[model samples]
Target: MKQIFTFLILGLGVCSGVQAQVDAVQKLDAVILSDSKLKNYAAGIKIEKLTDSVLSNNATSLTNLLAFNSNIYFKENGAGMVSSPSFRGTTASQTAVIWNGININSQLNGQTDFNTVNTSNYSSIDIRSGGGSVQYGSGSIGGSIHLNNDLKFSNHAETRIKTGYGSFNSKNLGINSSFGSEAWTANIGVDYVDSDNDYKYLGTDSVNENGEFHNLNMNVNLGVFISDKDILKLYHQSYIGERNFSGTLVGPSRSKYEDENFRSMLEWSRIIGKFSSRLKVVHLHEMFKYFENKDKDNYSLGKVNTLLINHSFNVSFNEKLQFKTILEYSNSKGNGDSFKEPVRNVFSTTALLNHKPNNSISYGVNLRQDFTTGGERPFVFSVDAGFDLFEHYQIQINGSKNYRIPTFNDLYWQPGGNLDLVPESSYQIDLGQNFNYPNFNVKLNGYYINTEDMIQWQPNSTGLWSPINIGEVASYGAEVEVKSHYNINEHQFNVSGHYSYTVSEDLETNKQLIYVPFHKGNLALAYNYKAVTVFYQHMFNGDVFTTADNLEGRFTSLNGYDVGNIGCNYTFFKNTKNELETGITLKNIFNEVYENVAFRPMPNRNFNIQINYKF
Candidate 1:
């Protein structure tokens, strides 16, 4: 795999030198934006929007686009190493990752490494599921993932490029650009990935030793209008990663890891007459390094920094009332070789209300409060409702209260830190149903959760390990979704799918909960026949136990699998400016002998090839 055919022949010689600067610009077709504060206060919460052709067909990572399109489970330790996520059955520090409206997790380990993100640097990707910490603060209890940036003004300009080559010697590159005027606007994204993941081990013959990895990502967005009621915004993101720590079919290793992240934000908005205002400022940075012996240069370091401020106000009061208010502040600092006191501060306030007295019905209410320097200060709330029972039916309901605090190595780890830990609470509820026709759509949901003081790190009586407030947990779930679209004349069709059923428990040893997966599902299909397209995807997972007492022999458990993938694409140089596309894919197909983590072996039957250019 020596540099994978010289980076696929230097990415086809830089796509033939940008195809001679492809002019006559006008090819921007990718849109699906929302997050006007969760579409105006999140009435019955169940968001799941991921488009832009499913983020350019999962342009690799956000854990391969939410484990092949969302019912989230992922535990990965190989094949790009370390990825985590479990949402709905919670834990990965209770899932939350939002950007472009703050809360970027990890103040020294609250979580968020979905393989260092990079889903082609985002331009909208949302997934909201149960409880959201009264609008994203501390680990939004089992749900929350949004990353957005969309701006538009008037005239336009564009550029796009992508390249890929795959299977064990993987490679990728991407670039995007945008421009607009009338006031101003901008967007940019960049991505790069590499892998030499080694692969092999299905029934064992070794290989996959020091699994390699690489990453880089960048994103930026800007906007300005500043006059007929002022507006301004800016955002930036960056990430860098490195990896090598895979070796477990009976060991032979040399650990290594490195990480870096940065984020910045600024915003302002205004309008007066019935009030509408917003202001935000944010900054975040994280760092990490570790090396047990990658030729021994010795390593161990950690760092964290955060600063934030936010303000919001909105009002309507008529045509069916509305209101919003928020204020927030934060400061965090951490340093490490296993901390021993590193600063924290927080303050928060929020309130929201919405009502609709027409078109069947709607409702929302949310509240939050927190103030901390030391531990628990929480008070949160949420209530949601919606209904419209005919002409395609709908109904929804929600409830919430969520919290999580204590990180910085669980409050200053030094031989086992834990100076009185508290703050882990949860309570949740959700129920929903929806149906629509004309081209079909359906959704259904059910949920429940209860948790309290549930933190654990065990080992006492002189065996060090700290962090307490143990035991008590429960989770329940159900979800189903389906979607469809069709056309007959030039032929186009699409379909989508999802399913999940979970049960996470520990209520005093009632078992289950280590890697928790009680079934999961996915499916996708597409067909278009004018410029050619074809696609397919499938996934399923079940049976995961690995010891929290639900164990069963041989390495404890992990046995359930189904995987598939297929692809096609074509669209040669077309009109109205420029375009070129080509594609190929075939992953796992039927060569599946899986492991989500037991001994970590996955990947067989693989392929990929892609190229795209636009202007």
Candidate 2:
């Protein structure tokens, strides 16, 4: 703890310097896609934007990038197997993942596995904290994560290639290229990663057996200017991966899982006078096969297909008032060995109004309603306001109602499926304050959420587990973030950090939720001197209870841990036409022994080297 404080003090006490400009590596010319809605309509929401430099530094996987940079907590079966997130103390299913303005959560499980997503494939990533059901739809009770691609229209062309070799025989390869003209634009990215993942378990002679895995991701985006007032865009993404589940300390097992995902969307936009409109057609497909034995051909298979149509219109009444409306329809079909085939159809409508009465005050109102064939639907609404209290201080507040419907596996599974389950509903409120200066920025936020009829799978009288409407739950938390950058001559320094305190309790038992930590934080520091850059990052996770009863035994809870990483990079052969850069990262420099999940030990100290070339 003392060392951590000393490091922070050193970063603050250095010679004062002028504020640094935005990194030259950022693609400032690109136009943001779906996130424009959030920026325009969500006046009081808290949004975090991951910069291009951060994305390039942690290009291996989304799990690695978020765990060190965001306030969300993650639990991994092992180093790179079956990772899930707990945002603001909410369950994994309560967090929504959006891709290209569409909700892409699994229809079978209602959640996304973070390990399967590659960070290098997307042009931008944004994290929105607080309930977002009014604009983003279901499974957004806690928060939402957005992955987007940007479109550029200019006479520009570039290509980048990167390769890396890491510990445990891990390898990474990535290629990205983009070209833009007066009439059209194209961007494509491909990434492949694999590992033998056989690290030795700390404090034990056993090794992480059967943990090898590999994944491939490909993304392509195209845009065409149809006319002076019309534009068309197309996006497609594919992901395929296979992994062997790691064995726990208690036993060894041979099991494998294979999955594939494909997504495509086409959109058209037009503007005339004060009115603008957009229409989108989307298709998504996901499939998975699980093998209990590595050598066996027999496996349980699941597949789902979804099609959606969405249209939205926006009109500006004046410079201070705006109105927007959206209508959407979706149909999904699921078939699997564990559950009977099922089909679901849903239709929804949303209305939004924004008013900026003056320069110091702004507010927005959003309302949505849904009708579904599977079960009853809920009406959700959100209200937000922002106030510029002074020159350097601002206050914001927001409240919303959110909901999540039951998944296919919850209602159609062979023996234990229950058809009577209802959607889970939640109400939440957030208060925030911000301080911005020339060189430093700070933000503080507090939030509370109450959920009714929470869904949980539990054993019944016949010892068969089935989904049921659990009681109520209450979750509250506070977050703090600080960032600053300074430049003196050719030397530059950047510092950023965030801390979260959370408490989630079950109304009946009055106990903390399992895997929900009470405190978590991380800090990052970087120094850039001409062609060389050095960086360090540290993360701290408080103890977490693994059991619902909040037991104190070693097998029931995990101890707190602190981990640090350091790296440096150098740029050479830099010129107007080409550039080459090489870097090395040492992860877990202190060799901290920790486990995200009980009985599942993480890897020890490791290192990786990467080289990148651009033209």
Candidate 3:
């Protein structure tokens, strides 16, 4: 027995040493990749991957791995071009989201709407919580989300096609393919969905009139590995969709909109003798059209076309300290009659330093400067520290000062919109801790944020939603999560859960911020035996308040609800040359009727089936 124990310990040591060597040679901060690159290295990544299943629908429309861990609240406005996510007490434009290391917010004027993205095209999706100003500029006040295509499976030439039908007359069709050699890879994907969401309405004679949505998405990637340490990638993605706006009017007219977003990325990375370099050029164009009534009258341009250019560099001079620098320049233009602004430009630079004096502790500091040709913007700065105690315990401390300028809609929006709006300034602090044992992981994060000059469109007695620079608002939040993975022979079990509570109040006036949830939680469990896997989940949303006034086109209703999902998977030929996986998903398993979004009531129980064949 003593000899066996000693041998096991020695084997573990050898494995650990090999893993450490592999980690040391890789870039620690950022990686340039397409979907093919992502899939080939998914398991070893620090990020998470949320999927509906193999070649099928995900939990919803978005892969949205961030939904599992971040403190962000967003409801899909499926019927319109504008999708908003509320972070802390800030608006949708405050948060930043990226794709393949590109700043999407800069190109879209600070909104990464989820309604249009097809989750099936992505290999990985991740969100970095709180103040990524060091690596990205502008819309990083709340946090940053990064997503990319998967490339690992591109080594072989394969094609996948999936189609499904469900409640509300929803239809979906998707196809994806990848081909590659030892030195080059290519991937292509196309997906389309059309849904007439005429679910059972509550207390109203008319069925929810305008809840129809149609979506189309495409993604393609080509890459070449020039050498062991040099790589170049070209990626293109686009989403074109039309949504039936949720907010309704008493007349026959229903809110509707069309959105087209397209992006191309050219990225190159090369490593030379203890130093590495990266460069990326991004081109994006978007068109947003909103119309009321079937005649397509009352057309309004929600978002105009825009372009962005971004770059970054990172170097590890020695073992103790590393350096990173980033720059971004963006130009925006609005055409069509609804918008008056011609064009705008913004640029920023940020520098960051990460130092680890010892193995147990590390500190990071970052400073940023920004320039906008049209407006006077404030500089952004932040600092963060991470401490590892006793190998399995960690603590992170962070603080940051951030600012946001008025969007085009907020500036010249006429009538209900404010023109003379100043940029909102905010300061925030966060404390986070996590502990991992051989079988379990526990994580907790507590944070506080204060904002002055919050911008909101509060209606006067006249019932108009007018932009107002409100007084300071304070918010404090806490989240706790735990996960465990256990294995016995060929049987396995996984369990995870998280809970978060948040509140925002006016500092002087003592009023609650609008439409911000105070509580959220998710629970998941999976059991595996032989070739079969069973998984179950429960997602809960706490109460949030919005305007009860019927006159307001936005925020006419809000509430809280809980939903559950159950799934099972079967793997055939698990150990053979042909591998196959099949699974099913049941959303809203309890048939609970709830509404987290106004006019956009929750969908009833839905079912999905998925299959995957591995080469």
The best candidate in terms of TM-score: 2
Best by lDDT: 2
Question: Using alpha carbons, what is the TM-score of model 3?
Answer: 0.85
Candidate models: Cα lDDT each: 0.81, 0.88, 0.66
| TM-score result, candidate 2 | 0.94
Could you tell me which 10 consecutive residues in candidate 2 have the lowest summed lDDT? 15-24
Which lDDT value does model 3 have at 597?
55
Off by over 4 Å in 3: 1-60, 63-71, 76-83, 106-109, 150-155, 202-206, 226-229, 246-253, 296-298, 415-419, 460-465, 548-559, 572-578, 613-615
- What digit string (tens of lDDT, one per residue) describes model 2 on residues 103-199? 9999998999999989888888999999999888989988999998888888889999999999999999999999998678999999999999999
Overlapping backbone residue pairs in candidate 1 total: 0
lDDT of 3 by residue, 182-216 (tens): 67778898888888876655445555567788888
lDDT of 3 at 351: 60
